[model samples]
Target: MKLYDVIVAGATGMVGRKMIQVLEERKFPVGKLFPMASSHSVGKRVVFNGKEWTVQELNEENIKNSHAKIALFSAGASVSRHFAPICAKYDITVIDNSSAWRMDPSIPLVVPEVNREKIFSGSKIIANPNCSTIQMVVVLKPLHDKYKIKRVVVSTYQSVTGAGQKGHDQLMKEWNEEEIQEMKFPHQISFNAIPHIDEFLDNGYTKEEMKMINETKKIMGDNSIQVSPTCVRIPTIGGHCESVNIEFEKPFELSDVREILSKAPGVVVQDKPLEKIYPMPIWAHDKDEAFVGRIRRDETVKNGLNLWIVSDNIRKGAATNAVQIAEEFIKGK
Candidate 1:
């Protein structure tokens, strides 16, 4: 058996830590695991596959020293912009979980369930789509293939944990006491929903929202498919929930829609409203598949349908998705 050396950048952060867990859960062929982080976190230890691996400081010199075959980077865009290309230069295929190269035409923004074909052996760096966009596209792919989707309007109820541990800590601060504090978020995240994620662009849409709009088109492999998005941060944890309304070029029966999603890979349908069984963050936390429910027809438009999608933003959204891309690459061999 051939085991590949794997390096995880930002190994101490929220997404980075989960990436290690997913790697073990899926039983990836790892020869040596390099857990890399910033200088402040260099000595910390992370448990993976029942062994504690010490974190290494990430830098151009140390990075160039490795012979790792695959690198999963969850560091911010700056780190990715500087080191990802360097890692690729070492012939390491990078699966980056950041907004860095998602919009770059040269890089393939991949959602394994939706566009595994975009990832190839020669592909240097693969971009993971935004957390909100991923779950929506997983559900959208099957419907789009069947109904020929025309347009999609999505409103995301994102968990605070999506902002990383600091956002979660800030929310906890407010929850533990009545006193409020300014956070990485522009406004309070506990007991309130902020209508912003990332910087607000001149077009009145935040960078996060635009990522959803454009990344959806790229992953779906159709620029003609329009997407409108409103990304909001809530005090919830575990997962992100999206209310998506889609219009298709062809009409689809409600039962067929349910059947399609139920059978789709990495998607589960939980649409029994009378029994009060629908997708929720609490249930979706730590789960791998995207939970989709609240399926119905939109009476206002032709060939319109609505869906509620939920998934652990850290799991399927980042760590699991990146690992799946690597799996697809391996399977292609």
Candidate 2:
């Protein structure tokens, strides 16, 4: 494979930092790396390919002038909205980690293992799904294909890190009994669960919750699949967990569901209820694969199932997913 010049946007953010780490850990072939960030972050250094690269302020001129072929953007939706098009016009494939273009009909929203075939080098922009949706879909895709998912109700236990480094700092400050700061999250995130995440819609559902509901349908490519989500910001630091109730179009046996997930790519079945070996955030931390366990039948409804899903929000949820999309683009898949 020929190495390509890549740009890491928002290099100072949590997910951006991990994107660089994953690039190095996966040994992604890169002719050069452009670490781009805001003006404040300009001149800062990020380690990549065993050496330090200085951060540059993101601008259309810089992106076009550098001739970067691929850019992994994690800055924010607004930043992506402004820069992704300019980069794409230069024939730069952008794998974005924000919610900016996920719903754009022209862009392919991808999770490599689930929908790698849907991706092509001709695709200029690819949206990585929300952290909650990414882990849920990894486990759901195989089952959806076999039994056909009819409806899904998911409640997420999301980590503080999902908000960013400021969220992490707030949690730490509150933990150490410092004066409370309420910037990253709306309310106190330490020893408290905030029912609200992102902005509230007219329907009373949060933006985060709706992302799960909407993104699930788009990524699964099944409009008939109904999804209702409740996203909560938990006190955890690494992984995000979900308690998912699923209703399948066809009856499924527990053993068969286990077998399918076990064989699915980027999925790890850790169900051993008797041994208490179910997946958890602490165990899922820093891991790339989605961890699934606590499997059992939801006997209240026919053809119903209950599962616990966990994955590192920073890894498989954001950085790794973005990099995987870029890899697919590079391979011309």
RMSD of each: 1.3, 1.1
State each model's CA lDDT, in order. Answer: 0.91, 0.91
lDDT of model 2 at position 163: 87
Each model's TM-score?
0.97, 0.98
Residue 28 shift from truth in candidate 2, angstroms: 0.5
Off by over 4 Å in 1: 178-182
lDDT of 1 by residue, 1-333 (tens): 788889999999999999999999999998889999899999999998899999999987767776898999999999999899999998889999999999998999999888888897266999988888898899999999998999999999999999998888888888887555456788777779998899999999999999899988999999999988999999999899999999999988999988898999999999999999999999999989999999999999999998899999999989999999988877774
Clashing pairs in 1: none
Clash totals, every prediction: 0, 0
